[model samples]
Target: MKVNVDLRLKDIPGQLVAALEPISKYDGNIRGVVHHHDDRVGGRITVNVIFEVRSEQSLDKILSTWKEGEVDIAKIDAFFETYPIQYLLVGSITSKELESITKGLEAMENVASIEIRYTGTANSSSRAALVTGKASKKETLTTLESFFKQRADKHNYMLIRGLD
Candidate 1:
């Protein structure tokens, strides 16, 4: 599994190293690290670390160690191996409808992540939204297609598969 850990560390010497030690101690293979020194919130710097762990148990251990080390974890995002699918929605897309659709997709059991890109004036009835989602299984992909199709039909939108 790939995990992204968002950390806020105090602006003290060795604070960054202290925060990262727990990941290595718990055997998390470090993939990338984005240390943002310029961005600070209340004397703390934001650090985004991406790593891979063998199992859920390993992730738990690493998080526990972070707590023990007094590392402030802002957020954690996890990703599993997934198949990607894209859909283009055109015609009469309101922000509320798009939000509803995205939320609905995210709430599904097999969906891992969703990214939406909308293009058109807010006041225009004709709009386009490009949506991408990651699914873990073949059945889930079929379900996703059905879900989107239903939404498009209900909202009178033209649904286009794949992005040009």
Candidate 2:
């Protein structure tokens, strides 16, 4: 079974390794990890780990070990499928508008994560953004593309989708 674990650990040296050791010990194979260093709640950092477990018992043991180590388990999700998407946005897009679009994308059921990169002066009327999102299905991707197209039309921007 593939599992996505969201954990919060104190911002101290070796905290990430300590939290991951239990997963290894319980025979959980790590697939990927996303550490949000820029995001901190109180004194803790949020980390998301994707791994595969052979049995339910192994997953339970890993959770138990996390509790014993004082790692805060924010969430645990069983993920079966996902798809990567990337696109570029051109023409007048402000930070506020970009945030609104990204928030809307994040609210979709199939969407997992959204990342954007933009570089433009405050006074510039023309700006560009590289938008990336992960969706669980092709239908979701179609929906997202439609949403982006509508948003760009409303804002008089150009939406260029990347080839997968």
Candidate 3:
């Protein structure tokens, strides 16, 4: 079974991973994780973790682990299937930079996965990419904007259909 969890934890180092450790401890493999920031008002951190579980009843252990860790479980959801969206990431290409780009995307809400390759362009040239995600077009676009802005590269976003 695939389940989603919304957890609130202290915005501290290793706290996110600490809260997530129970997923593996409970025999669940994390399929995705998104940590969004809402700093304008309260300094609360929201972490959305998606995992595959062996038994639906195993959620108890997961919930208990969260409480022990002092993490707040805002919500949990089980779904039969996921909604997918695709987007284009076209910008400067570099094997070294892709890691940062990929990590940035993963730390966002609704971004399930990222696939990166390169286009044969010069150093200051651009490349084409395919990013698959489990979010709405709007959500994905917002994630893209945040991820793409970290670097001083020219990245363009073109929403292919079915992302809505």
Candidate 4:
């Protein structure tokens, strides 16, 4: 999993190295690190580290090590796994129908996020939209594709699965 950790460390020499060493020691691959030296408060500075670990267990070890070393952890964010799907829709679909499509897809189980970008003028009757969705499971995306196909058939819209 990819993780972003925000840490507060004392404004003293060797603090950054001490805070980062455990991540490597526990087999975490460091992607980026930003040390905010100027933004100091209460003699401490904030450092942001983005890293990836093989499993949650390895991340837990690094976090515990930091806790033992007295590293003040402010925040941690982990990116969740997602299976993505995209569709190109072209037809005389109305705004109300588009909204209904978005809402129905969002209500599905394991659907993480949905993004829709429309092309052509809104005033024109013929419009195109790129609908992108990410789900926690691949099967969920497959279900979404089936659902979209049904909607497209009923509405007489052209639904292309992949642009290429």
Candidate 5:
């Protein structure tokens, strides 16, 4: 079975290896590991690890090993990537705030560009943010939403996620 395990870990060094080491021991073959740095969500570093393995038992063991030391499974899903994922952020967005959001994504690895639409107050939450990330479609979607959610909550914005 192919399982997608999403884990949130600390931003400090070596946490990535710590999370991956256990998976191999449990006969989990990593398909893709999307490691990202999220400034929001209490600044917890997030990783969307995609693995192909057999049996729920092996997955459970790996999960148990990683369920501590500030490591958490945000989601465990069965995922497949066709291509890249796209997101739209529509709300009252200031240029400066949007710039910060872009910078935050840039600070993480694989975030390519943030092309914003600048809708200019079409509604109560009527601004647009177009972000492109070099992450697996599912991981990119998850990571982007998590970041947007924190920024929106802090600054009162609404985000919508879908295909471009």
Candidate 6:
């Protein structure tokens, strides 16, 4: 899992190194670190750290170590090998059909989240829906795109896919 964590550390020498040690100790591969040194508040600076860990347990260990050492964590977000997919569906789409499509995508395994935005004209049979989703793996997303393409073909709709 890829994790992004925002931590506020004391603006003192060695605090940065001290804050980073636990992540490496817990076997987290540090990807990037952004230190907001000029934006200190109450003698503390904010650091945004992005890292990949093998499992949730490793992440928990890192967090626990930080807490024990008095580190102030502001935020955390975890991603499971995320891949994005977007499609523009153009046809005579109805609300019920849209709901069914959304439900179908949500039912698939490894699909983290799915969203669709619909737009319709006042004087035409053509409608547009912007479908966006995030999956845990590239293969899962590819499978989803193929399924969507089949649906589009069966319904005689034009499917415009967004560049990966």
Best by TM-score: 6
Q: Please give the lDDT score for candidate 6.
A: 0.87
Query: Every model's Cα RMSD, please?
Result: 9.7, 12.6, 16.8, 6.4, 16.6, 5.4
Give the alpha carbon lDDT tens digit for every residue of 39-83 in model 5: 236777678888976667887788788865457778888643333
Clash numbers, per candidate: 0, 0, 0, 0, 1, 0
Ranking by TM-score: 6, 4, 2, 1, 3, 5
Worst 10 residues of 2 by lDDT: 78-87
lDDT of 4 by residue, 12-95 (tens): 899999999999999999999998888787889999999988778999999999999999988999986677778888887778
Residue lDDT tens for model 1, 79-133 = 8767887998899988889889878887898787789999997556789899887
Please list the residue runs of candidate 1 whose C-alpha ends up more than 4 Å from where it truly belongs after superposition: 82-164
Worst 10 residues of 1 by lDDT: 133-142
Clashing pairs in 6: none
> Which digits, one per residue and each the tens of the lDDT, describe model 3 over residues 1-164?
67998887778799888988888989988999987776212456888899987666677788888887788878889764445645555556565556666777677775655565556553545566555656523446655654555453443333233334
Write down the lDDT of every candidate, Cα atoms only.
Answer: 0.85, 0.85, 0.67, 0.86, 0.71, 0.87
- Candidate 3: residue 14 lDDT (0-100): 93
Worst 10 residues of 4 by lDDT: 117-126
What is the C-alpha lDDT profile of model 2 across 134-156, one tens digit per residue? 77666788888888898999988
TM-score of every candidate relative to the true structure: 0.50, 0.50, 0.45, 0.52, 0.45, 0.56
